[model samples]
Target: MKTAGGDAAAKRRAGERAAEEVEDGTVVGLGTGSTAAYAIEAIGDAVADGLEIRAIPTSFQSRQLALEVGIPLTTLDAVDRVDLAIDGADQVVDDPDATAHGTLIKGGGAAHSREKLVDAAADRFVVVADPSKLTARLDRSVPLEVLPDARTVAADRARVLGGEPTLRAAERKDGPVVTDNGNLVLDCDFGAIESPADLARDLSAIPGVLEHGLFVGLADATYVGTDDGVEIRAY
Candidate 1:
């Protein structure tokens, strides 16, 4: 079994590898989560070494980290286009038979809505992950950002789609978890997703659901951190 420290190191390796892809004089999309944090730090270090780039953060967490690392911040509306986006996935489907290998499920940090917006707008989107995140299929719980008043309706809709929807609860606080957009989150479990694209569309069409955590064709590549080194899979 891999130790916690080993997993962390693996995440760092993948994140830094993706960070190295960023070039000077370009706009980057900074992602959320622990793995993406390493990429943000690497970019910050690059900035300290005179790399000039503007970054659009996917969440409050990412924004704060960028500030601490000295990566210049910009808004999506302020930039003409995003050159590249680096993000972490909660689970990645690494199917060998498929043409591409970066099908992913994200939103563990409740930032998938903004992350999707930034990632989809970028010219290239790279995913960073450790070996533990890799799987033959995406069977993880899908996170849904729903309107505060429509939580029940959204859950019912998810259940109608043959999913078990549960309101995500805050760890340090009481009651359900609220997103950065002042919305509620529903984590729906649909065992062994047969078709991610179709499920994504179905969940998206539901009323009151602002966004769902099913990233289909957004990833251009994935850097999987291993004990030996980082494995790059192009999508």
Candidate 2:
């Protein structure tokens, strides 16, 4: 069946849940991207309605959005810990539990380096996505963050893993879009990652790999907003 307003509706449901999950005086890790943008706005609405919480953003974009939405801001350096981190994913899986895999492919906005760091600092990670993002297998859409000088080298290494690696599509004509940490990104196609953890490990072992957008079994659960309604998947 065709999903009605698929992406937009799914994002709205996820953002609503994210906003409802916060508590007074809570510390949260705000994520980046279009879906996370909604999550930020939902939290802001909550704040405007008297749900006060301090949010530490994972990227510059996130920070700005959070500010614009009226979510109180702080730095990870200033905050001791995050109660939870709400983010989005490019794809998920049929397994509701691992629907999106605790692991994820992020930095679609080129924030992988910092996003990874912030994720490492969070205690709980929640990924929100539309049902369409759920897949039976991971595929060509893998996003890889690499050092500029080692772009070709990294692409070659990814080929050793049975995938073709291409530079991430750049929106700007004058320059490749630089990540928040100054790294360049390559979108790789590994087809189906039988062992995402192993793949993530291999990629991480590479010298020039700043971070691969793969979550590698890091998520506890995912909330999928389907055409019918919201479904909770635990993994």
Candidate 3:
């Protein structure tokens, strides 16, 4: 495992490498989380250096960060298509045959509902992360956004899929963590996932599942920051 400072530095390097894809007069998709926050800052700096770009943010947190960095903001509804999306992943598995972006487990920050939307809307989606985030297989719990009223139904479905579902709770506030879309998040632990695409389809078919963290066929490429240098993996 990398030290805290090493992880931060790696994340910044990955973010900077991804930011190199941005160009003037492009519609970019800004993602959420700590790794993506570094990308947001880099994009902000790019804007300061006179890169004319409009961004659609995946979360409120990203929106604020983009504003602080001086990147112009836009809504998805106002754009025809996003040129590119640079985001981060919780876990990335190198499975070229599995999906276009390989297999990614995201939503650690609880913004996956919108993250999925923005990722799919882009012409190209790039994931930026440090080496610590890569895994031989996805073993982390997949996050599913559920409607408030459909929590029980979602949990039951998760159980049927061999997952132990737990409602994510707020750290500061009481009760469940609510998404920006006014939904609850269920962290479903299925141990090591074998087929991420099949599981993603199954979870999507479930009623009241706003979105799940299994990002299939969305990643065009991934930039992994390493001690030696940045590693670019294309799918």
Candidate 3 per-residue lDDT, tens place, 1-235, comes to 1223338888888988899899899999999888888888888998998999999999998999899889999999998989999999998887555433367999988999899999999999999999888877889999999999999999999999999999999999989999999899999999988888889999999999999999987888899887767899998
**Structural similarity to truth (TM-score) of each candidate:** 0.96, 0.90, 0.95
What ranges in model 1 sit over 4 Å off?
A: 1-6
Poorest lDDT segment (10 consecutive residues) of candidate 2: 93-102
162-209, model 2: which lDDT tens digit per residue? Answer: 878878766767667777778888888888888777888888877788
Better of 1 and 3 by TM-score: 1
- lDDT for each of the candidates? 0.92, 0.76, 0.89
Which candidate comes out best when scored by TM-score?
1
Q: Sort by TM-score, best first: what order? A: 1, 3, 2
Ranking by lDDT: 1, 3, 2
RMSD of candidate 3 to true structure, Å: 2.3
Root-mean-square deviation of each candidate, in angstroms? 2.2, 3.2, 2.3
Model 1 scores a TM of 0.96
lDDT tens digits by residue: candidate 1, 1-235: 1223339989999999999999999999999999999999999999999999999999999999999999999999999999999999999989878533577899999999999999999999999999899888888899999998899999998999999999999999999888999999999999989889889999999999999999989999899899989999887
Model 3 stretches astray by more than 4 angstroms? 1-6, 95-101
